[model samples]
Target: MFGNICTLYYTRRKLIFDFLKPGNQCRQLVPEATVDVQRRQRKMTSPDDESRSFFAQTELDSLKGKKAKLARTGTHSHVFKATMDSRGNAQVAVKLVDLRSRGEYIERFMPRELAIIPRLDHVNIVAAYAIHRTPEYVAIVEEYASGGDLLNYIRTRPERYLQEQEAKPIFRQLMDAIIYLERLHIVHRDIKCENIFLDSNLRVKLGDFGFARELRPGVDSNTHCGSRPYAAIELLSGRTYRGNGVDIWSAGVVLYVILTSYFPFGSSKDEVPAIIKRQRSQSIHFSQRLSGEVRSLILGMLHPDPKKRLYSRRILAHPWLAETPHRT
Candidate 1:
């Protein structure tokens, strides 16, 4: 009886092992498991999966092409740099003028800049290359100045004093640009150090013509315009005065700052009113260290009375300027 029982147990164990194996009975019990295993195996080896895996790689080539195209051009109204084209054949600086910040001024002024700047072929002015206008954006393309602006140059080289010798040439160049504008009856109301840019070879390019206005023959502009520190006394006083005189006064202020690295008048914001009052009340002063001729020239330019201030022509012909030989 014990032998019969051991044989019966062996038979039952074999039958259970057969039932668990992959066959008709196991398939009947776990149909979904077989399908799931096959699906996973197919996913591991499928060409569709490989294609999806490499999709970004394929898209990258097209994106690189787009990036290359973007690199060739840049915007200016907002700060940006120039890029090279796909073939690397062209380079341009793009300026994006925000319609929101500028408002109606952008609509009125930008078109004028585009129409005016390209026609102006002066050596001292930055050349306008192109203008692109879209419903969403306005861009002005210009010649890229790798050397940046004069303000940055001066700030970076603080210890380097612009000696009379070095300054004379730059002054001459600036005068040429200013005189050219005057001849055209275009008054660059704003003339500050930052508005001037330099090329790689240190050639000056007067920029930012936003404040420029065409002066009709025999017409006097009484508009109060220009940076405060450089503005003439008459302009700050809200008095209608000669445009040329105002410009010359700014030039004098610029020259003074360039020479001494210090502003001649005012400190805090409240002091400006008093400074203007003083300019009207008293004669302008120069440090004792300045030469008598230089002092005389500056005072002549800064004269509170428009009639007394030196005109651009007279300034160019002044003995101080004539005596100093320009290097470049």
Candidate 2:
């Protein structure tokens, strides 16, 4: 709802580039010193492709000649894995969004996401090297996670869930990315396990920013974006909500799923209304397998009241994250 108004007033590029620019409405949200430090850190930590430029141009012919396999599909985009160089060694992920689709996402959300990905340069975030746009499609070249997304990783596991020790560092890294985005005032409205990627070492790298946006102080987002199960009750109930709270709630759901390998509310998407009902009633249940501290932290983040919900900073400081996992 708010996005349509934004599109009418500001060009898509302006909306994306002006995120932390001086004179922008939310520029003061992040300090100049913090931005400077991030710039230096990006130079030191960003991969070679990311350091080149945000809008590095890739020849369409190069992509056309490569053998690509469909990696995943989203509501508005298809991600493919392909080799960027000869010998099929330099792997990369290419996200293709069909521009001609009449989908609401194509007109409202895609442009902002396309613009935001390149600007992000965090270790725990997937790096976008180049973007190729055309009337038919927009192709985004990104870092490839050899170990795949967390959803597939968990689903394929024999036990269907990570041991507490195994889940801790991965969740910590995911929170690191969330904390970084929080500092930048960018909220990843879609923070589910499917969007959390892992490398060969199983290190966390949060991907997929299709439902993301920059927030201004005192302004509330009216869009009901993101996966229903991972969405906050406020969004599901069609209430105007703060972006950070929405993210924290989604992250809580992610933590719950990874630790239990099951959704906290309902079994399927058709049960979202029931999920909302349960959420509002606070009729939540935890797996007996979860530790007391982790359960308390999850409850804190999943608080029905947005005002009382634990934010990224508070979640990071929770004793559960710092505790050593004991074998059962």
Candidate 3:
């Protein structure tokens, strides 16, 4: 029976792998044709001249007391760390997305995270201070979290995780962020530890809404967009499924890693057949050191069936949350 199940799992995985391969899939989903046209138009126009004139006229009135300095360069954007913004007189992080170079249609097609961020006002969510758009680039100014992202924090301070009492509050803060996203009908496709930022007080703030998609009242998303290990079985199956459930599954993986410092589904580099077989058969095992409630919560979130998984709101009200109070 076990061997038969393994064979079926391997077959399903191969089908998904074939579907994702370059030439086998339809090109329409890639939007390459649209990008090509936009790229041609961009080359004809004088991008530098347009940017200079636009920046000069804009006058940085909104950024009154702030002094922006280039922080780091991401794959698609340049990050800036600005000192003391006009609104809160607090440090802010700004991301400048170079649309002119990437292609004109790319900016338009790219997710309007600024529009979505302002609509979301939660203690556990990173606040969008201001948005500036020019012909060359689209800039988003947001509150800076001094404590940095969860992944970096974990790497620097592995001892913090050993203190379950301290970690409880942080977990609760993460739950708050997830609950808020669910209420907005937004599913954060990527919910890994790296995406969760921490303020000076160590309060959680969910960042990077690039992969997030809004779900209509009765509609569900089918896009397989997220980190591989965090992806749920339904997503790995290459079938259209509710994105919210996938986010819950990723959160479960994050929770497991935070507690045990290891992944539940092994690693992404593992053999495809072995990974699928293990995931399909629900062959996950937790360390004996994990508490009963924590194990139960992780299992609840990692339910194979989306319908059976715990919703964000319910998770916030769970007994584990009651034991750990999250303060803004």
Clash tally, candidates in order: 12, 0, 0
Candidate 1 lDDT, 9-127, residue by residue in tens: 11111222222222322111111111111111124358655433222122112112112112222122443344333335233344555454455457555555555565565777766
Per-residue lDDT for 66 in model 1?
A: 18
Q: Which stretches of candidate 2 lie over 4 Å from their true place?
A: 1-60, 63-65, 86-88, 323-328
lDDT of 3 by residue, 125-164 (tens): 8776545555555667676788988877877764544345
Q: Report every candidate's CA lDDT.
A: 0.57, 0.70, 0.64
CA shift of 95, model 3, Å: 0.9
TM-score of each: 0.69, 0.78, 0.75
Q: Which ten residues in a row have the lowest lDDT in candidate 3?
A: 1-10
> Ranking by lDDT, best first?
2, 3, 1
Which candidate has the top score in lDDT? 2
Point out the higher-scoring one by TM-score: 1 or 2.
Answer: 2
Question: On residues 95-198, what C-alpha lDDT tens digit does candidate 2 reach at each position?
Answer: 87767566778888887887677668777888776565544557776778999899999888788888777788888888888888888888899899989999
